[model samples]
Target: MHSFSTAVLALAASATVVLGHGHIRRVVVAGQTYPGFERWANTDQSNDVTWSFTTDNEGPIEAANVNTADIICHQNAKNAPKSVPVAAGSSLQVVRFNTQGGFEHPGPEMHYLASCGDSGCANVEKTSLRFFKIYEKGLVKGGMADDPDWNMQKWATTEVHKNVQPEGEGFIDTYTVHIPADIKPGNYVLRHEVMGLHRAHLGEAEFYPQCVNLEISGSGSQQPNGVNPMEMYHASDPGVALDIWVDLESYKIPGPAVSSVASKRDIESSPTLKTHARDIKHWLSKFMA
Candidate 1:
């Protein structure tokens, strides 16, 4: 049980060998950029203690610390009290940064959501937080030649995973996810993360997680049935200590599966919805052409 301070000190001591790390700069909702850790920590209130430390201390959590308190949000930034208001069901984009170069880590990307108590964002407990998958992306093979399109469908019905280009280039990366329309209106935490398996062959997996606080407002009333956040993964879990070079197909994304209250019964009841969705895509393609 490594304390947050212990993890920070260890990370600082080995800062020289830390491959790369970054945080969510800001979240875009309805095309509006809201102040997140990066914005608040860099502004006139840069001296604010909660967010300031993140500017220099942002990075990946060691694979073995997945169960530590720091696992809640990278480096246990629990005191960084900041939350942005958003409408339920609104389109949301989490903007991420790739420290050294482009996103060179090859593995799946994922997003999870959890609710906080009425005591407000400031009093939310990280261990009490339970999350259900909202989005995930894994490898998708297209044609026989080299690379294939990995872009997912507009909205989501389950957890997803996608592949990161081994030779991609860029400092900034963006991933899209939506607030469950039926989600209860309240405060929540959006955990945006990526698991880099490049060094997994050596039994080391790197997790880059950035958490954003959000106050959602809408007519929705359903709550997510999620798993205990702390128990989501274990240090010795196959997914956490993996060998990406071998057994690629056997790899499974960590944490509980996505369970959208609104979509479950509907998707299950209307079998033709899948066909209709496919038809809509086909028609849209023809219309665009």
Candidate 2:
């Protein structure tokens, strides 16, 4: 009986790893926090239209599958409806959670945006979407607190690290990116991704990516071009199949370089804006629950 119970417990733990990894469950837009995949799955899009709800598991994608079609937007984001409305020049904060615990993975965080039409979220083909990077957070010097640049990230410095510390007991989870004010008005999808390096020692880096649908309102005409979805990252890319445990100081960030079409200072200087980048406590209360 003891052996049987042990087997049963093992099976349950495996199931949780397969079905309950992590996902973006909350987003903050203009200081208002809105429920993401979790809440939307029950109330707004009950039919499992969003990939976050219908995916077989929230487990991280294996590095070998980085080039597969699944890499485009992960499981079922293609048909997910645009669930949120955001304005240009606004800072959007994405919050991720694990079913078993808080974010426990350690690696870089990335944010990308793709333009679709006014109602394009309801029916977007993965291939038809092109993405441009708006925010990225990579490891600092040696990833140790003693390192001079320890808390100084190469990108997304203020927003991503505001809630969590790098390599802390809990996963450094929250990330923020600004919607370019110069972007043309339309519906867009925000693609957020986190690369987990805990298992990178085995050449099996894990990728957690989710797409958030939104309607963006703004006035600018510079639509940025992006690489083909299939060509975004290669399985052999240093960033994809890496061993983060070995190299502490010489790690190079994987994937395409960050591209921004707007100046970040503009967001902070807008006369009508009430809060700027240093508003750390704004998003803390919402995620406390």
Measured against the true structure, the TM-scores of the candidates, in listed sequence, are 0.69, 0.70
- TM-score of candidate 1 versus the correct structure, residues matched by position: 0.69
Q: Please give the range of 10 consecutive residues that has the lowest summed lDDT in model 1.
A: 141-150
Backbone atom clashes (below 3 Å) for every candidate: 7, 2
**Per-residue lDDT for 1-289 in model 1, tens only?**
5456434433433342333456555578787776555542335533221222243546567777877766676774653466767887776876665455434455567677778777665567777877777766543221111111223211111112132222234365566767778888998887777776555545567777667777889998888677776678776776677543321223456776667553442222222344567688999999999
lDDT of 2 by residue, 27-73 (tens): 77877766665542437644332345445556777788877767767
lDDT of 2 at 238: 67
lDDT of candidate model 2 versus the reference: 0.59
State the weakest 10-residue window (summed lDDT) of model 2: 266-275
For candidate 2, the TM-score is 0.70
Best by TM-score: 2
lDDT of each: 0.58, 0.59
Write out the backbone clash pairs for model 1: 136-160, 136-161, 137-160, 137-161, 137-162, 138-161, 138-162
